[model samples]
Target chain A: MSTAKQPDPARRNERSRQAILDAARELVTEVGYAKVTIEAIAARAGVGKQTIYRWWRSRGAVIFDSFLALSEGAEGLALPDTGDIEADLKTVMRATVAEFADPGFEAPIRALNSEIINDPELAAQYREKLAGPVDEAKKARLRSAQRAGQLAADADLDLALELLYAPLYQRWLHRSGPLTPEYADALVELTLRAFRP
Target chain B: MSTAKQPDPARRNERSRQAILDAARELVTEVGYAKVTIEAIAARAGVGKQTIYRWWRSRGAVIFDSFLALSEGAEGLALPDTGDIEADLKTVMRATVAEFADPGFEAPIRALNSEIINDPELAAQYREKLAGPVDEAKKARLRSAQRAGQLAADADLDLALELLYAPLYQRWLHRSGPLTPEYADALVELTLRAFRP
Candidate 1:
């Protein structure tokens, strides 16, 4: 019995929590956020509605958390550091184009957009939970380039990040244009040229 | 009788058409899109609902047409061309910030966002009737700059336009940051540098 470890109930609870989030994400993808409910998520996860209620305040909270989790997994998945800002930005942008093109994430993202207009509460949650983190991370990367003398010293960090990122979002939500990888490469190149001192 | 002059029925009809559009815009701003109806617009316009139906396919049509008419008035306002592309872009962007800050347009923009989500048919109309013209105008202006050698020869025109424009839309729709002239100027400067060859 020497050096043996005790089993933890906390670990079991954590597994249940992840299962609930996975079920919510799956249901949201299938039925849309308008149709997703705590009861349905609970049933799918084999947990109780009370379990969901205990953890989150609204259906939006559950969905937003799921999205953040997915994004977190994909964070820095393809951002390049080839020492050439143009090539690196293009590499990252191309990868983002592919991610946004994925059918798995498209429905969930569109669902988020559909709710942002009518529901201020959901909109706030969406920005704080998902958009804010992604924006800040990208901004940090751009700022790092600036600090490394790869970009102009006085560059507007927020605008620089937005220039590189926002067009992809505009296309995805509005269907204004094809979000192809070629489109991404073009954005990266244009922005990289524009940013140089 | 030697110099018989005709009263222009076309002029009179144009005034009446504008009056109806004004009333409809006012009503939507006051009551919101969900509560606005054919009967209500007709009552406010002091005309028959048939008159509105004759011109528009639906209430969405009326609201959208009203916005388009307003934007046409706003269009000739012009992108400032001070010879320097950076300064000119900044001037135009600052004006845009001021325009969005105006409550007269802000309410309508919110209404438009909701319409885009709640009614797909209306969204399609908005894409054609509103976004298309404005977006194309901006793109054309950017392309003119590229031809004038203000930007790289290989710059992607669409992406260049988005790089200059998307941040403002992101900020306004999300309410995440200030819609100030200074912010617009910063964005212009940043984009100009990023796209510079």
Candidate 2:
């Protein structure tokens, strides 16, 4: 048999990187962020500790990267422009509720979220990587709605955005209630009325 | 010396309980929740582990009791009936923002909140001991506003209450933004507008 072409070094490196991220995600979910260690990730990924260290500085960094990778592939919090502002917002909010309730995403997300609350550096990283982009996108959508005369011109978009997502997040973090589609719909309705011209 | 009033057993027990709670609070603040063990708390309080275990089942329970005790002495979230619903809400919200920003309260609260998010039993306990009473008080105030014609009769008080507090809690949990008095004021304005008749 013809000798198999030696796998490209670049491809091998990428494969190892992806494997390490996947292992981190799995371990964070299975054993939790508190219990997950770099050694455990290296062992689970079947890579040398040096290899992981070369790529990521710490367990938090690895998990954060993995979280970004996972979210990038999922249906993100993009507000669709369906011309009907209320309907578009409802769609986005319902999608958010679904995302929060997703079992595959919940545990690791909660662990990371809790860590972010307690660690200032990680909070900054999270705001830059995730919250900032999402906030800007929603604000842009709200400005468009305001221009269309669907919402009050002077409505505070920043507070408006908080109104849209904060309730769902509170329910999730506090375990105070269910993050159901109906709950999402209610938030959208109340927020729309608040912003109505 | 008058024998120190015979050192009544009841008084001694109360003193020990207070000391244990004080030690738990200080340890949680100093070393953090993860590092604050029962043994460490016992050593710090100059009490035996059995004394702690006799009153509370876990370190979380001790911390929870300490949290309740600390909050009991602080200015609570009482809604004043100043005839103007907006001002009353603003006062309450501003108090919330101040409480959140208190440096002495921040670390232990964050640690306990994160733990509550992760643990189901602790979450339920938190809801009952803290969240439930607060929610009911706010809801009662909203109902009074409805009766006074300051707010819409059909306004969903439950959702309105969420609008009032969810943003504050979200900022605290996500550490995505500053929990400022201005932020609290903005929430009050938006929520009142949403509920206005």
Top candidate (lDDT): 2
lDDT of 2 by residue, A30-121 (tens): 98777999999999999999999898777778888888787672335557897789899888889889988998888788878866877788
Clashing pairs in 2: none
- Chain A alone, TM-score per model: 0.82, 0.88
Give native contacts recovered, as a fraction, per prediction: 0.60, 0.83
TM-score of each candidate's B chain against the true B chain: 0.81, 0.89
In model 1, the number of clashes is: 9
Interface RMSD of each: 2.5, 1.2
Give candidate 1 misplaced runs (Cα > 4 Å).
A1-20, A34-62, A72-80, A117-124, B1-66, B72-84, B117-123, B143-148, B152-155, B194-197
Off by over 4 Å in 2: A1-9, A73-78, B1-9, B73-78
Cα lDDT tens digits for candidate 1, B1-197: 64347777777668767877888788877976558888888887778888888788878778877777777754444455555777777877888899888877887777777556545677677777677767676766677678778876776666666777788887777776789888888777767666666
TM-score of predicted chain B, candidate 1: 0.81
Alpha carbon lDDT of residue B25, candidate 2? 91
Q: Identify the leading candidate in terms of DockQ.
A: 2
What DockQ class does candidate 2 belong to? medium
Tell me the chain A TM-score of model 2: 0.88
